[model samples]
Target: MWFKNLVLYRFSQDTDITAELLEEGLSHQPFRPCGKTELSSYGWISPVPGGDTLVHQSGSFLSLSAKKEERILPASVVKDAVNQKVEHIEAEQGRKVFKKEKDQIKDETTLDLLPRAFTRSNITRAYIDTRGGWLIVDASSFRKAEELTSTLRSSLGSLPVVPPALKQSPAATMTQWLEQHAATLPSSMTLGDECELKDLGEDGGTIRCKHHDVLADEIINHLNTGMQVSKLAIHWNEALSCIVGDDFLIRRVKFTDTLQEQSEALNAEDEASRYDADFTLMAGTLGEFLKELITVMGGEEEKEAAGWETKATVTVEEGVEEDAPF
Candidate 1:
């Protein structure tokens, strides 16, 4: 119900997204357990446990989950098996095992070990804000978020979604905020205890501060030395706190006790009801917060006109008789 991190993607205006369309598209790739010898399997799943639907709707928000099952096979174990086989073959035949044969042995070893490997499953939850045409993923890194998006893209054929673009860079805006010590910041946002600064030089260095004042003299001295803020921690209207990175990543998100208490006050009788209600509240709150953030950063960057095409060149081999009739 709660997300610890946020990775945002905005859908194009032309994309006709809806709950029914998502449910149908996602049905084509429902969650399946990993098969033997397969490294991983990813597909859509229900966000609520014991729920049958792939898409959970709460007002304009559509919740979705992607489950990934992966087999754990140690590389060292495969390498040791390959090496032992190579040594045995070389000793018995009195000949060196070349790279090609050794590689084959490694592949065989890996396949042989895969059946015995332990399997683990992980679920990544995300929601589409239909009102804003935004896809918000609960992931710590872009790689993890992309895994879910990639699967969703494959399911839907093509997904016209891209990361949020801002008119002003987060680093420069945050640096200016620190320089003015909350004077230039919006009334809804205030400085938190953590920050990360980097030197804008060939041999760049990083300084990360936690549990220290971001506007303290020591930190200001570093800034005076031409260091720029790469990440800054901030509290948003006393409802949420998170670290916003220059790369547009929101990390370490914590919802305030007030928000939680409000959710708890709903007093749902079952897990499904509670999840739905809590998600609705969270999505509504975050929608407003993100809008305020976008405004504070001077609004979103203008996107290019749609339906542009790039010309591609193909080179055929001189010896090949292109699609010759037999």
Candidate 2:
């Protein structure tokens, strides 16, 4: 499966964790269908469907998928049912149902309707670079990514991971790149046709452009007016294209046809083999791209910024109890 977005997190270099241990920890929270009256449920699932392996492994790269099931219950339907029950109780007892009684009736009605509610299922994919101490989630939303990490933390009893924060602000860098055109922009990256610029001040406002020259005078004027580049689309290293946000999230990722052709030439025989090949190819390429992008952003230093703390490094600790309840 291809990832449309990435939420990157870095772990301390000293942190040690083995693939086998990760698999064991995740097995504690294996996917289970929602209960009769449950509105939502979440748990880990096999990255490769039908495979007994909870963690899909290829070299030091490990992948897993989290499944979430949510039941659909309309508020109007529940409210209507609650009102009908309230009316029936009032008629039978010949007294008006008070707020407390109405609240109890609503709870009862919700429980009765829950089992019959239709459910929708979704899966979020995440990969762990054991060698690199990186956890990359294929989620566009921060909340969804946090959910996956939260479950992992609960299962493992500890998780030392945090989002990447560069020393220099990406918004400032992007704004400078647009203002200076090819001069300030990294040689390996070129501006694409889409971008988003926001004012640095409280009421500075925002602007979005599509299929327009990012280096045009009109766009430059906004950047000149103290608006910072919060998001910009760029083609990097001539292999991948994506919209990079100020928060460092990459979205709408697309690999060039040349990369796809190279992958096709490999011609893996089975599903598992193909998955391994694809994962390796993607991880290797993106790993390099990320390194270059970091360098472009003036490289990561040892300094810790506010709100960005290095928790436990992903290292193996001996004699520790691994048998924590899920």
Clashing pairs in 1: none
Write candidate 1's Cα lDDT for 226-267 as tens digits: 999998899998899998888877888899999988999999
In model 2, which residue pairs have backbone atoms overlapping below 3 Å? 15-313, 15-314, 15-315, 16-314, 16-315, 16-316
- Estimated TM-score for each candidate: 0.92, 0.91
Local distance difference test scores for all models: 0.84, 0.80
Model 2 lDDT per residue over 218-306, tens place: 99898778898888888988789998887787787898888767777899888877777777788877888888887777666563543
The all-Cα superposition gives candidate 1 an RMSD in Å to the true structure of: 9.2
Best by lDDT: 1
Off by over 4 Å in 1: 305-326
In candidate 1, position 27 carries an lDDT of 99
